[model samples]
Target: MARLFTGVVIYSFFVFLIMTPLKAKPSDKSKTKQNKYGIALIIGNKNYKDGVPPVDYAHNDAAAFKRYVIDILKFRERNIIYLRDATKANLDSALGTHNNVEGEVQSFVREGKSDVIIYYSGHGVPGVKSKRGLLLPTDATSNNAELVGYPIDQLYKNLSKIGAKSVTVFLEACFSGGSEGGMLIKNASPVFTRIEAPKSNLGITILSATSKAQLASWDNNAKHGMFTNYLLQGLYGAADQGEEGNKDGKVSLLEIKEWLNEEMTYNVKRQHKRRQIATVIGEENLILASVSPGRQFKPIQAFEKKKTVARAQRGAYQTPTISPSARASLNIHESYKSYGILPIKLKGKRCVPCENILIASLEGLPDAKILRGANARKADVVVSSFLSRLNVTQEANDAYASAKVMSGMFGAVLGKNIVDHIDRSTPPSFNIFDVELMLTAKDKNLGVSETARGIYFDRKDARQPKQSNTVKGINSVFRQAAERLAVRLMGGTPPPIKSAAQIRKQWEDKDQNAQNGNWSEDNND
Candidate 1:
């Protein structure tokens, strides 16, 4: 079955499974009625005539996307305008006034106030003269962007002119061509300039594959662009976070962004050994799509089933649940007499303090028998730790602080603070850390390996008045993480790790305090 569906064929099967309606069940007709006039434009340019290299999977990506928006999102097939290997003239006829297609799209949008989605997968070049982002057509040349390239700003303006109730844009191409899949142009600069959106009431949202300076990756195994593959998964219901406490099959833009961030960060790190930060700019709560009840997409079920079978075959060596007395009688403690702690590998900035705290906590554990230097290498077991921080930026911190101040001043002048009111409801840019610890036997004769993983949030920095004890607060959090990891290694069950919502709530509380100027010296230890 796996061999029968590989590459593009497998993705088609996935789309079919997701689109097929269940038997004897009512369709989501009621919900579809509200968005009956939704429209989409999907363009995939793979065959470039100029010196620019061709994208291997752009056409296939466009095909899969068309199926998803039509089958899962319930968009009318007649309303979707799809183009493959689009040339400059073809794009002008479709998007501009050269042909009847553009006029038809505008009329439909204006008459019905439709929801609009525009997706492009191809080579993207940064404007050398205009300093804007450009999406290239199949016949476009890189040197003459002004004449041939489709300016992103123009794209936004054109979509806004359609007067749709909401517009969503997905650009699966990167401005800076540094992809690992050998899909970049020759002599492209590493500097990235962000594509700007128009400030309008059209409720526009944009999801870019990567930042200006980063490379958008291609996943050969999945035979799709890394960003688009995960995005389809989210739209197919893998990102449904049950916003109303029940998985009623609705997926919001916010949930999709979360899933993309988590999956892309891990995948890019493993595959490219570099970072690819996806950018999401828009109203987060906007509804992208919804699925029928009990309908979900699982792309890698066959691989997962194979893994389960392999694990079942190793049942004889599986770890057993033993009481304290039984563990002592079996001399389990003697088996792991001396444990060595390696110098932790840090993946992000400002993580030295957390590393120190973890080392200290492990050393302080009574009867843990941790060793250092030469003696540590001859120990029975060795432990190593990895720490990664995501979404930590100076821009985010500046925006948070500026919003708080502006909200307070506006409230004093207008008798009601509009900025403050909005800030109270908006989510804060909390710094998230992914922490993992692994233990392995030094001799390899013992065949022992144990692992623990968790995510931690640093929220105290946002709510504190003076930010004097920020390092102390972070250290405290690290200590708690270390203790939990130790307990798990010692065969004890700690409480479950906090969910994404719970971590978000911690930042939300701090944001409220910062907005109210009611900061306390309390630590989140």
Candidate 2:
């Protein structure tokens, strides 16, 4: 009886360990559900008085951003403060009490007592402090302009006083360098602000559009200021891609940067030529949570389970048992054993392009204009280049034309948006490893894809051949194939060449609609 009891006890212990994983542990469950709330302040300033402002297209950015946060992003409208025309009165009203901007922010935090404020989408201009960053306002003046622009430090200070726990800011503009990973001035001394939650130990995260020395692009493109649109998509589901441990249906701040940097850049390049970098700072407890961990669990399974089948399939594709002499001669595969093509089928086009077209249409309005001399090369060249890659054959001209017609008809009403369209799918059927190589060959290529991230090329190398060589060499054969493909493309001997120029034109045009909120949602419905 004693021996039997011992065995039973051991079995029970194993069961308990297994059950613990299936059951929600203490750390698994969220602390509070009622306290859950998010606050967003989206600002876009386009009006300016003076010489060659590089921000003409930003006029409607703020307004478009407001809708994204409230309607598309699903932030509670009441909790959001959107400012399009940043006149002094509007700025003060939006930021002050009894108004939608800062004042309302205070009220929301005070009332719901929840933490997490998101500020995204805006332009930053050079300030008097030499390195000081300024968020431009509608009625801003060049002389005392720095005074009118929204100061990021003030935002941190104000939110601190409100006792908020965490703040994540996403700014899509030039000169976003000063906002994160730097010392925040308190009266004068520099101090770390994000590392510590301003009030009640709250954490903060700031993601800027580009580095201090770099510039961000703005226009009517549905891409909607590279950084912000990608940030938005990351929040929805992109961050969670390939994620297996999403306990609360959420993604962490880190995960978001990883996924957005790759996914969004790819999406943006399909329209704009430029690639924007999103810099993240600080930390947070919960950024994104998983909705279905078990259903999507595939960590070890992806490799262990798939490898065997993959190898078996490889046997069939093995070089046709070439002659013994040929086998002994030379081969690229043996030297680069780990290197291979990552076969992907770039899907999800139905609503995506439609949305982009509508957004680009917004620029057609008198208020809209693309950012001038402010990283235009990045958007124009890289984005246009990718669009030329689409397999939209001349035979599909009717399909492409039909899609455009549908976009124009619906765009007149629905406007461009980033609403959830479809389940994410594989990338285009082309082997990405090969695509990277071909891109590298083009004197105007974005650059070699480093881990398939960024806008198909490095922003600095964009439109410049010297920069293309900077692309890191990873998969040699794939790269060579892609280079060959690029040569074929530029040579204009490939199929699906209905007017390669037209394809590029459409892509550029679509980007304009996406940022401007002119993408269509319905087809004559």
Candidate 3:
């Protein structure tokens, strides 16, 4: 008995020793480096001037990133500069004047011994004249961004003067002069803003939410910018654990970008029915953060669960109500697979262009198919619309006209908008259109029907009195109405329809190229 017990104890001890990891317990993968010589400038600008739409959840985004910087990245709270709804003066005070790059940030740097991080969640506009990408400060206007806006190149130049060992920049704004659901600049003749992409210098690395011509999205459920939400998720260890990552614990700059590329592409496509690709410049092996409890990352599963909820929200699309007359047609799925979009009736008149725009809006439903101008009997579903109201009012843009106002009578008397052509201090005005419509969807095979009412507005710059934006505005209304009806009948809400300017640009391109250009959506990217 004594020999048996001693042999069992010796064998168990040997097995335990062999099974243990040789590297280190409480493994280094869960450990992050202490960045003592790093300084961060985090700014979230949401409430801009009245004309500009607020960047919803920008403050939340900034707050979350600031927390990660201090807690996860091991940055000291004292080394961080946090700003919300920052103004031009605030920018100048923190990063120094454009003329001389010397501010609180400059004072913190240790002359080639520090790493600098800059993150901005706000609006970015391009110079109407220079076409330079400019950060739209709270006190700035997109139409006159060149003067009041902070230049991106100037920002890089100022940071370069600090002489940090390396600088990393994260921009949660797009410079396309288009807001999440509207236009930022009111331009005459539906001109393309053509804002250039935000760029960085050799020593500076930049990760922007959207490329030029793309609009950044808001994740209303997360209460954060879609880009910023995933950004924090990556910093929270998901990036270190992704398949592209080595799972060695440290999350590198390259690893996070790779993770963002895959996740952002997939989520934006599924959620918004649009393409929003994060633009990354410069590939460095610099470690951004580290995972904890080494290789025990659970964020992947959590986020996947959230995605599944989104998928469920976009539930199996079926007719909301069915008639008793067609008993056999009441079955779902097979009965309403395609909808024939009839020409929308505008104030009791047929408008083919309005129908075309409405048809374009439903083009994104992945499960259901759209049949343009198909007969009601031929299609499984019949879609139609009636425009109830189309109203327009001309008004001055407060952001631009507040500087100095000239009577529209001057242009009215001169037979043209002389103020616009003369480049006078008296700014040009805009046209605001309010459109209301009732959209109807009839599941023909199911003998069911549903109706949705939608009201949308479009603002167009009236710089040239000769050019009328009525057609574009009406088209925009029909499109928005279609989006609303699509959600009511098809379960998932689509992205905001294109602005009047974008629709006009398409028409102009079609005319100029004689339909041979084959304009593609990716061109805007």
Number of the top candidate by TM-score? 3
| RMSD of candidates 1 onward, in order | 27.7, 23.6, 30.2
lDDT by residue for model 1 (352-421), tens: 5554444443432222345665566666666665443333322144234454444454446434534444
TM-score of each: 0.49, 0.40, 0.50
> lDDT of all the models against the reference?
0.59, 0.40, 0.64
What's the lDDT of the predicted structure labeled candidate 3?
Answer: 0.64
lDDT of 2 by residue, 163-247 (tens): 5555566667665322221211212332111211234343556677664354465434442555655555555455665453243
The segments of candidate 3 whose C-alpha lies over 4 angstroms from its true place after superposition are: 1-29, 188-201, 294-525
Which of the two candidates, 1 or 2, achieves a greater TM-score against the reference? 1
Model 1: residues >4 Å from true position, as ranges? Answer: 1-35, 97-104, 179-191, 200-202, 241-248, 297-525
Q: Compute the lDDT of residue 285 as modeled in candidate 1.
A: 79
Query: What C-alpha lDDT, on a 0 to 100 scale, does residue 354 get in candidate 3?
Result: 69
lDDT of 2: 0.40
Colliding residue pairs in candidate 3: none
Model 2 TM-score (2 dp):
0.40
Off by over 4 Å in 2: 1-37, 51-74, 96-102, 176-202, 218-223, 242-248, 264-276, 288-525
